[model samples]
Target: MRISLMSTTLAQGVIDWSRDGHVLTAEQKKFYEREGYIVIRNVVPQYELDRYQKRFMEICKMKGVAQSMTVMRDMTIARSEYVPGEKAIMKVQDFGDDPILFDYCKYPAIVDTVKDLIGTPNSNLLAMHTMLINKPPDSGSLTSRHPMHQDLQYFPFRPADFICCSWTAMEKITRANGCLVVVPRTHKGPLLPHEYPKWEGGVNPMYHGIQSYDPKMPRLHVEMEAGDTVFFHPLLIHGSGTNRTNGFRKAISCHYANDDLCRYVDIDKNQEFTANEILDVARKRMKKYGMSEEEAKAVQIDFADIWRLRARAVNGVRQHL
Candidate 1:
């Protein structure tokens, strides 16, 4: 997929600028508005990071070796052979079911900044998605290189500006360790066409990429230390490279939305929406649960329902039911 860049436009302001209790400085907000993303350094406490890392290992042990493949919040986890000695557990999706993971999502520094970006002091916020990614070194697959795409492609929400993502590094993230790369100001544009990347073996249908991404666009390599975080718009074009280094690169991320400001789109009738990947996952889950097509339809449970379940409220209240 290749997208051509035509012109750059400033992001349309969706923030409640009059709101108080904002933690971001004026300059930081300005930068975010201009670039569609902002990196906050050392916002996560070292102790918290360490605790979460330990908890991840503990969960891996609890899951046991026999549970090599487990699905959580749409992310797929598997044991990796790339790591020497002990096999490294690669967790790629939802961490909402875990208490420690939920704590990280509501971490004050993270949620405060999120409120500054997408909500007023009184606005309710929802933790829309969560993932704890462990990228194994030399995977030699698309698993490492996340193709550039907009997060909104999979979301069934409205008013993209009301949604944001907080991605925090659990350890030093460098280009060698597959740090994030983002196309600046891309969020100001509408969502582009998305398609599965051309890769051998089966690719996770949920992993969609922009059908057209122009290389000429202004791109940034977001390198960071442990506890550093980046809050980005849902429509921002971004992805990561391969971990060329010799160890596992780990990160925890969660998407957030102003629950009072966003609503669910009609996926079945919305011509502008492309959530085939998410729909496919819902279908598979239905089958796994022994739900026949008629039963699924009878209950009115499908991709949108699955996504709604994924959207858990971590702060204030959830407005969209």
Candidate 2:
């Protein structure tokens, strides 16, 4: 593995897990500290998973949507003739408007565990980003394969350690179905520079990646069954392979933050920040929906504004961020 000096140095130190109400065992804490992630088997119940699965299909089958949820297409396959309409859907955002998804996000099993990892006694926990990813199979698109990168790149929040993600498998995940692949201990290193992938056919610039991925990093494929959840650090270098199977690989994930510890960074000065990339995406979507340039200009909002609307206090008290 090509280990940077900073990562190597951090790996040699121990992570402090001191907290008011931690639920992780010593071993689990150690694993997260050393590897920047942990998979808690069956953290979500099967009944809950079934509910979400059913709701997801219902949404997919709906004909006309009137603004409650945003359905995003796989940019890589959006222009392709092979995938059309809802079949091109890569993710469903702002689904929290649905009671089922909202309740699931606040489910004690998920909240308590997240609190253990990145919570504080005096503050609340916020669900910063929520989405249901559907990695379609047999589509000749790069959407199924995410480039190696850190989650923090897209987030404007400070103190990277205060942010984390809980990704739950809604169905069986395997290497053929694009299971998550992560590089251990990468979270301990500083946030590296990121740029949009320069693929010939084009890519979803919203999903930024490292300038160049080191092939020798200690990468691991994380396969899981339904109800299994993986909690990972925001800075962990991770991505997935293309789905070679005949079915879609489905997963629901929410990025969380310790509201007390996280605050938005000044994006205006940080021209390279990924928040700028996300804003560009929003503008493109607006234009794609047939909005005139003037119309888009009049209503355009930055990524932070969009995230504020999507965020919800899942535990303790609500925080204004």
Q: Which residue pairs come into collision in candidate 1?
A: 2-212, 2-213, 3-212, 3-213
Best by TM-score: 2
Tens digits of per-residue lDDT for model 1, 86-155:
1355564566667776789889889889888876667788887888887767545546677799887777
**Candidate 1: where is the Cα deviation over 4 Å?**
1-21, 62-88, 200-205, 267-274, 290-299
List lDDT for all candidates, in order.
0.73, 0.75
Give all TM-scores, in the order shown. Answer: 0.83, 0.85
Least accurate 10 contiguous residues by lDDT in model 1: 2-11
lDDT of 1 at 74: 13
Candidate 2: pairs in clash: none
